[model samples]
Target: MTDRVLYLVVCGAPLAKRVGDGVRAARESGWSPYLIPTDAALPWLETQDLEGAPVLTANRKPGAPKRAPVADAVAVVPTTFNTLNAWANGNAGTYPLTTLCAALGARTPTVAVPFAKHDLAGHPAWLASLAVLRYAGVRVVNPHDGSSTALAPVASGTGEEVAKRFQWSWVLNQLQEAGA
Candidate 1:
């Protein structure tokens, strides 16, 4: 198998499909992508057709061999309002949150893409969380300003054309620099 990158999906129902599309694109580009869903998201993911991608459970321990740092970059696609708020406040209570904390601790470059209803996305709490995440060294990408959805291709260009268009390229460069 090709070396894989860890892709974490928080809890956006709409964003999951977009994320899956991005995963398909990334895999087509020759990267093995793995999905880890939050506890609140498992049931939904099970009901959807994810094209056979593996799902990591919330309760799984941190030391499993499969959990090793295999990717130079970790992307948190469609981060929900709750999860984003929790992460900004340093709450590592769930699998996705804990994994994110670990990745940050290890100094892995991360790209967090937040998705919420337009009103919620503009709320003060969400904005504050975005600021906090930036302060914590996480690259925060949003679907605004004509960027594509952070992970998936744009369906109608409603949101940003894509958040952090440079992300995958940056990650690949980082991996090359590390001689991975």
Candidate 2:
């Protein structure tokens, strides 16, 4: 896995605050992880903590890391329902969306760990997006299917209570399973 780059795309979901943990987890799984947070997710990130690991966001200053490495694999953890629908519809409105689209276009293996609320999970758009991504060869991990830690409903409060619900390990496992 040396030299392999795993792009971790973080959407603006509640669990996005723990993206640094996900990056570390990805490294443990033998990948050099790059964190690309959607514009909506930027407020959750603490720049100092992500040293060495490249962080790509919507508003890059003159001296910031301007380019993301070419990805061999992509993991979209904290894939909120909105992002899922947007990405599925090929809406590259954000860098995170464009990066995911580029990876899919190149046939690079991609794994998505969605954090949709229990309510929205049943919506037609959500289901159809999942199906579309799957049909396009994206590996989608549903937390509610008894496969990993269950995400709390959207109303779940912040801090320790909700933190316990995100299945961070599942993203690492999926990326590894995709042969990243």
- Among the numbered candidates, top lDDT falls to 2
Instruction: Please give the clash total of every predicted structure, in order.
Output: 8, 0
Model 2: residue 178 alpha-carbon error in angstroms: 1.7
State the lDDT at 11 in candidate 1. 65
Best candidate, TM-score? 2
> Per-residue CA lDDT of candidate 1, range 121-179, in tens?
66789879877777777766544432322423234444343433424443333333434
Local error of candidate 2 at residue 10 (angstroms): 0.5
Give the range of the ten consecutive residues with the poorest summed lDDT in model 2.
Answer: 144-153
TM-score of each: 0.70, 0.81
Looking at model 2, residue 11 earns an lDDT score of: 78
Candidate 2 residues 1-180, lDDT tens each?
547788888877766777777777777767888888887778877653664788877646688765756888998867888889999999988788988888888889898877766678778898798878888888877543415334333444443345456666776676667776
TM-score of 1: 0.70
What does the lDDT come to for candidate 2?
Answer: 0.75
